[model samples]
Target: MQTLPPMLNLNDLRFFVMAVTHGGFAAAGRALGVPKSTVSKRVAELEQALQARLLYRSSRSFTLTDAGRDFYEHARASLIEAEAAQEAVQRRVAEPSGTVRITASVPTAQQYLAVHLPALARAYPRLHVQLEVSDRMVDLVQEGFDIAVRSHFAPLPDSGLVQRPLAVEAIVLVAAPSYLAARGVPAAPGHLTGHDGLLTGVAAGTWRLSGPDGARMEVAPVPRMTVNESVVLLGAAMAGLGIVPLPQELCRAAVASGQLVRVLPDWTAGSVTTTLLMPARRGQLPGVRATVDFLVNCLQPAEPAGSAGQ
Candidate 1:
């Protein structure tokens, strides 16, 4: 068998590099929190392993020989690469990295995520986000999604997924100024029966509302048009098509800008609770967990300092 080279000790290489950069073993040892004798011994071992003199030592003179200069160049480069490798791994462990795939409803993605996700990017530059916008409910595990945003009137069924409630926004009836001008705004839920109704979810459904006096009723209106997407419904209402029930946040700006007006001030169409869902397995990942926490912080009220999730 061919004679194999001696195994090189990484610590010895580090000590040799430090000794050269710090001017001497004593100074290097001070920087390394070790004794000068330990630094000298390690450097000596490194030179012996390489079968080359990497440093000259005497009573009054200390310097690098021709062999030492060549070895130092390669050794310095190796140490730099090794440190860079170490830092790369430490960054992955300490900070969030890798791609996180997320799914959300069309309206939520546009109004909330698109607005807030830029902050996530600024906070963790190493992290990558893949956003999927869909109005239909997605199977988190089956669809291979890391996270999903869903809104429901009732409690979500136990689907073996971790659920985090983001917000509970009241559904309000809104109509364009033109429609309210022509159709007349309904003062009470009963008055909504005849006006042209724009609905979102089903082809035909009731507007469940409760009054300021705690009276509740459901009015099934004949649909002028129906669509499954909330954004489409918002567009229709803004175009003076008809009154549509929408999450308060979805149309707050329109209502503020005088483009649309709330039909019944005291009554709501009901509340839709938005929840963030993730697979139990996926939630355990560092990248996914950080993303979930970031979204929660953005949507919910602020918690006390240091109480933020990991």
Candidate 2:
């Protein structure tokens, strides 16, 4: 009788490579156009066949067990070879052409799609995009959004969403020049407590008011007028309601126009970051890939590099 190839399955090996590369089974599943559970099962089967735990899964992190470490050392070449083979097959096909729908928050929605999209539209005339702007989270499939750009810390759940980081910007504390001159600039960060605060429902939207000797505190802002949207808060700041913590993009125009002044130039406040998220499917649609490629270029720091770049 012929002996079956030692303990591991090639398919399982493929799944393992995908998991490590993508950082999780779900992400791998999205890339492979398979259900997340299918990815999990393949990895589980591989572990059983080898009688070795390859991945140490934790609530917060994923690590390679000793066996996984050893496998990674060698299997990368095999994976690369397989990709080369696949790419050779795909090259015979024509370039991407189709309609793509993308979603974004107010700021990027206006900046990228409204202003810059014309260039992309001119390049791939056949390639069109339906743009949706909103602050609420979108269900890509249900809402028919082909891709989305938004700021978030946790990766989108394994629910058929593929997320890639773009860039991160600090949430700056800014006020109108008149407001600062009138208040004579607070003596310390704590004095900010006395100033009005613009608030939002988002976690990163919350401000950590800083003070002396690492003296720090938080402002539970109940703005006389609260807005869930970043754009609205920015408008409130421009109108001089009080101090608002905002992403650089939100205040950039105002600061340049002298409609707003950056406060506490030395002290950092909150942050705003963005990610590119898409639906999991084999052979990405033409419109989707185009947007992804452009966004990769748009969000890069010094061309491109880790975390978001990765």
Candidate 3:
């Protein structure tokens, strides 16, 4: 019988892949929450096992050799398949008792998902949850995340993953009572141009509003400040800085507390759909299913009254 090649170390392969993908040993170490020396050592061991000089390292940079480039393509694919296999087996378990990792934008995690997690824990005491909050779109399978929550104004692109609608998010214009008292309230969408605006995302200076009867208008306001995070914009608006468009659910507490007031009550800035996404293979996993069900149950659609514009 022919003898097989020496068994490769899976951990070493993982470190090697991570180092290449992340650009350096230090970066891979930070991502893995390990020491830079550990990452370097692991990759060295992988090279020794394969009997190949995979990387050319200098004081300033490292580049993959021809052999290393060829190996990386296969190694990355193998890692993805291995993770898929692990998830497939985990899905066969009947109880939701292991760790389930989830990713969502920072504001969504803090304002919506975080509040409901305690109830989830109460329902499934044995399930451990790992929540990662970020603004970037993460590759769910590559990142080993069980689920992702995303918000988009238009239909999301077809990603081949299973998606479920969580809520229809209404975008509404808001301002602190102090701001309106000082600058005068805007009675029509056209009047928004004269107001100081606090803006976010790509639509910093522009807003599209739709009335209840489906009449639409676009207005461009001169922004006093621009920020990327909704929570920060909300804070600025509440501090009497400027009028801002925000997701209704994110500012509900402030509106209820009378810290912020709706502007142009007859028109909505726009609407977005909040969605829960997961790899199709993980749909049958007990932990994944449980988390999906929990979110669907907990996150009810925003009441018209709660949104700044009715």
- Among all candidates shown, the one with the greatest TM-score: 1
Backbone clash pairs for candidate 1 read: none
Report the lDDT tens digits of candidate 1 across residue range 33-130.
Answer: 99999999998888777888888898677799899888889889998999999998997798998999999987778978988899999999989999
**Which ranges in model 1 have alpha carbons more than 4 Å from their true place?**
1-3, 56-60, 88-99, 114-132, 200-205, 211-227, 239-241, 301-310
Output the lDDT of residue 270, model 2.
43
Task: Evaluate candidate 3 by giving its C-alpha RMSD to the native, one decimal.
Answer: 21.2
Cα lDDT tens digits, model 2, 111-169, are: 55566677777767667678888878888888778888887534456665787778776
C-alpha local distance difference test of each model: 0.84, 0.71, 0.86
TM-score of each: 0.77, 0.60, 0.66
Tens digits of lDDT, candidate 3, 19-103: 9999999999999999999999999989988999999987797999999999999889989999999897776565577889999
Cα displacement (angstroms), candidate 2, residue 280, comes to 2.3
Q: Which pairs of residues clash in candidate 2, taking residues 3 or more apart in a chain or in different chains?
A: 171-270
Would you give me the overall lDDT of model 2? 0.71
Runs in model 2 lying further than 4 Å from the true structure:
1-94, 153-155, 201-206, 209-224, 301-310
